[model samples]
Target: MPIVQVEMLEGHTLAKKRLMVEKVTEAIVESLGVPADKVTIIIRDMSKENFSKAGKLACDQ
Candidate 1:
């Protein structure tokens, strides 16, 4: 089994997240020759305040 983790600022719709996971699973399955069911994906949705870039908080951008 392969584990993949992705973290992004919150605000995406369920449809987008579902599509993202589907594509990610497909890529993992094809690359590792593993079953889709055996691939593990972890998606973390964080608040803008919790993420930062260029020495500034995302919420402040």
Candidate 2:
């Protein structure tokens, strides 16, 4: 079993997220030889204000 975590800024379309999961699952299945049903994917979405870079909030950039 493989547990994958992905974090990204909010507002991604459902299509994009679906494609991401499909690709990620394929990679995991190919690399780890794990069953697709056994793989776990966790996606966390946050606002731009929740992240910072160079001492500035991402939302401010």
Best by TM-score: 1
- Candidate 1: worst 10 consecutive residues by lDDT? 27-36
* Model 2 agreement with the true structure over 1-61: per-residue lDDT tens digits: 7999999999999999999999999999998898999888999998998998799998999
Clashes of each: 0, 0
Model 2, position 19, has a per-residue lDDT of 96
**lDDT per model, in order?**
0.94, 0.93
TM-score, each model?
0.90, 0.89
lDDT of 2 at 28: 95
List of clashing residue pairs for candidate 2 = none
Candidate 2 residue spans exceeding 4 A from truth: none
